[model samples]
Target: MAQQATPVRTARLGRALGPEPTAVSGAVLLLPAGEEISARRPSPLLATASVRALGRRLSRTGREDGLVAHVVHYRYRGWNGPEAHLAADADWAVEEVVRRYGDVTVCLVGVGMGGRAALRTAGHEAVNSVVALAPWLPEEDVAASPEPVKQLAGRRVLLVHGTNDERSDPELSFRLAARAKKANRDVCRFEVHTDGHGLRQYRDEVIALTEDFVMGAVFGRALSRPVQDALAAPPPLGLRMPLAAGFGRSLRH
Candidate 1:
């Protein structure tokens, strides 16, 4: 019998666009999606094509003139516990990015537990915008989590969740958005398809919103009208779902 070759695992590269700012222009944080166990171990949820595509879209924003994108990796609490520890870690990461990068604008993007982390990070001084995908900030956890709304008041936030997500209901995202809006923050919400707590169905809209949010934060422009209009349109479907077990297989490159 012939020996079987073991698959090689590649480090998921965190990409930055534009020159490292002499004074940091802006920073975007990307957190892994899933519960604590899933987050600790590699899973297809984090390596989906939509996830990679979102990263690429964010990287493109960094290529724009006068803007830089800094992507940082952080650990988040999936379903293991409430978000206290994850929030603390997120705060530390945000502060570190600000300290190292200078007075850079900050944007937090999280999917699932990562979304909760992003909201927690929003309490930091440098965070100016947030994009939460199917975030898991339950009402009970809000008291324990940092006051992200206070820190993010008057900032721009885009919340997207799948109505079919069973892990964390989309209505929770809506409730969070409502709180943000009440604080006079610029908030936008989008609903997508899928029942497994993933954002595969809303990839394009998510990417566009992310780009728009970052650009708007750095340059003081309103979200691009086209992007906003597109988001307002009805949700689209038929996106191929990535296999949770096969994510690392595609990283051979």
Candidate 2:
């Protein structure tokens, strides 16, 4: 019988859109969603398709701040249980950014499973903050090995979840935010009401909010009142902060 062949891993940073590396002051790493388990390398994922647009918008908007953005292409489609292959890929991407940019601040922006990976990789020295959009947080269980919050120390974390998200539990993200807030007072979670996992109904608002948070975290730009209050307020209030409409407009003025 022929032996099983291992799939070739191809985790790497895709083409970036932003200022030249030498001129960059800050950076954003975009991680797209993936499956829960599979060794096969990922093809073009729906999540990746959506994130590409977001990445372009971010790159364009953040240009004034000397921010460069890159989307990470994962080696595998699956989280692979404890193996956490996605997180490892994200970690490598961070190192790669550090290597190329040299001391510039980095923000990790991830959606769905990629959100979970961003949270997991926050401990990297180059990472200054994280933005998790509709992050998929698994229910606490011994086997699943609940995602740890200790790594988030000193790093600002923003978690955005849609209330109607069925694909990933909003409650789980709330719980994780609460835990992360306890560990690092800079943590906050926002609820996008009436939206689902995709957050398409208010994509502009979400992007604005994300841009605001990333810029603030990476470049020390002034943060909006809701974000500031969310970070300062104690549990329950902070963990359940509402994402309001016209937020992007507010940022503009």
Candidate 3:
């Protein structure tokens, strides 16, 4: 007899960031929706289960209880694009989500190269929080990609990596976090089992940690109910144009 598939868990929540039409006011977390390829496939680090578990935990914090969470995926490519391309693309997605859902909180979770892209995008004006799992940063000894570490100065950043990453040096993320802390930024680090680079081994812990970080950053106790209500309301229709276009253009400039 064939074995039954493991049932995947899922969670949904609301957005709490701004008052806009497309803002995603809710979130969903569950197992990724696609077939699993070989271990070497370059998939996004934050899998479906990660999103669901994280969303559930965030709901408990009373901050993102109703926010809608959706699985987010970005195109993969070589990192030789313009300096602002990655950031712009990230901002555009955030805007698109807001335009569709209405002022909402956004949590971008990434691993490996995706983590690097998430860091680059975190500093954008539109991003709310960033969680990077086993992220890779450009090495100084090699031709370096544009450094996005500076943009992380004022943002909330979470870096999770294994000590035994062979594909990319985990120390790179540590050094990046150290630099961010040196600049007085809000950054957190989590070191998981030192046996692998991807987060498959420590999924639960990583999801819980990510949920806590997002709640703390996006819904700090200081946020007032009026702000929440305002975000829930509709946003001006055309005001978002420049923001979207500006971000798109930044990628090519």
TM-score of each: 0.69, 0.93, 0.60
After superposition, the stretches of candidate 2 with alpha carbons farther than 4 Å from their true spots are 1-7, 18-22, 45-47, 142-145
How close is each model in CA RMSD to the real structure? Answer: 10.4, 2.3, 14.9
Alpha-carbon RMSD, candidate 2: 2.3
Q: Sort all candidates by TM-score, best to worst.
A: 2, 1, 3
Residue 35 lDDT, candidate 3, scale 0-100: 18
Write down the lDDT that model 2 would get.
0.89
List model 3 lDDT by residue over 1-84, tens digit each: 999996542222234222222433443222122211222222455333434455444554433345555444433233344533
Q: Quote the lDDT for 168 in model 3.
A: 65
Query: Which of the two, 1 or 2, has more lDDT?
Result: 2
Clashing pairs in 1: 35-78
Q: For each predicted model, how many residue pairs clash, with residues at least 3 apart or on different chains?
A: 1, 0, 37
Our model 3 lands, by Cα RMSD against the true structure, at: 14.9
lDDT of each: 0.58, 0.89, 0.50
Highest-TM-score candidate: 2
lDDT of 2 by residue, 93-147 (tens): 9999999888989999999999999999999988989999999878888676667
Q: Worst lDDT window (10 residues) for model 3?
A: 237-246
lDDT (10s digit) by residue, model 1, range 1-253: 9999966433232555434434456677665565554335344454333355565556555644434454444443244454455555567667777676778777777777778778767867788877777788665464585335666675667777776788887766766666566664356675664534765555554556566666776566665553344334332310111113222222210
Greater-lDDT candidate between 2 and 3: 2
- The superposed Cα distance between candidate 3 and the true structure at residue 108, in angstroms, equals 2.1
